[model samples]
Target: LRLVNMRFECVGAIDLLEFNICNNVEILNCDFAPADNDVVSAISTVNSSWLTIRNCRFSSPATDNGFDYCLYAAGGSNKNLHCALIENNIFDGMDGDGTAIHIEALCTASQTVIRNNLIMIRGAGIGIDDDSDQAMVIENKIFHNGGTPLDVNASLSLMNMLSDDGTVTWSPTIAGLSA
Candidate 1:
């Protein structure tokens, strides 16, 4: 287990973390820097049995990325990826096209749980694409994006999305996303 926050760098500073990782890690109150550079250095590519991201804050306003979607899962998508937990993180202030605002799994990522995250993006909130299955997204607040809140274009069996207040709604605008 590990944790990172304001103490790691100057306030409003930008940093990047890259590598293949394992084990449990937490990021909180970390204002990803370069202040609108769009280049996301703080990313993880992993073969780990499990991964967890919590209480982090990412801000970018460039065309490249304040976030990257493809790096999180080297395996494939939600269906093939293993356990991952993302909780209470904030991805906002992005003006460009990021990799993803939240999570994108082509595999399924069994036992995957995303809870209480706040995502404000120029495009895309949480996207689970390509034959994914069985994920729980609960208590997340998403708003003001060029795209939908939760976008799942594949298949799922027991995927659940709950608002912070414990309520949800399904929409017809998106193919297979609810609440």
Candidate 2:
């Protein structure tokens, strides 16, 4: 499946795009901005493989009941993602405790690349939350978020820039930038 050059707005109470048990999916040059506070995620993938999401924009209105995420991907033991690429995207103007990007339970053999993205959230929100060593997080500029910039369990994070206030501080052991 391929979705290109599309605009999704105000899709209420659900994910704008969802992929479950699907493969070889591509989403490019898209815009996702939901005014509804009940909206879950701009994109959600579960047990998908070979997926690519690039050149996209995601934003949501401020809500006390924070939405889940701008992008969410999860894989389990039986059905794990073989590969995924999320790059060149922009996420901004979000509020509350929701995450910009959330990934979890990826297969050890699988490779997930998240790079070259811009993430800025208004309130106490995380920039990225990845819980897989198979993920490579690189070169993303994350700023103005009230929570952790890159909360990753991955072993391959490189060249990423993060700033909550005017100052930026990160533990090299946490980000895996050092031995």
Considering every candidate listed, which one attains the maximal lDDT?
2
Tens digit of per-residue lDDT, candidate 1, span 1-179: 56566632112323255445554555555555444444443544445446666667666555344554422454453223357777777666443444333333454456777667666545543432222435565555555434555654324322233232234443222455533
Q: Which portions of model 2 miss their true places by more than 4 Å?
A: 61-66, 106-109, 169-179
lDDT of 2 by residue, 1-179 (tens): 89999998764678877777658889899988876455788787777778888999886555553356888777576655557888999987455777888877554325878889998856778888876556788888888646777887545787777776776644233544442
Clashing pairs in model 2, backbone N/Cα/C closer than 3 A: none
Candidate 1 residues lying further than 4 Å off, grouped into runs, are 7-15, 61-65, 68-71, 76-81, 93-95, 99-108, 123-131, 153-179
Model 2: weakest 10-residue lDDT segment is 170-179
Q: Candidate 1: worst 10 consecutive residues by lDDT?
A: 7-16
TM-score of each: 0.62, 0.84
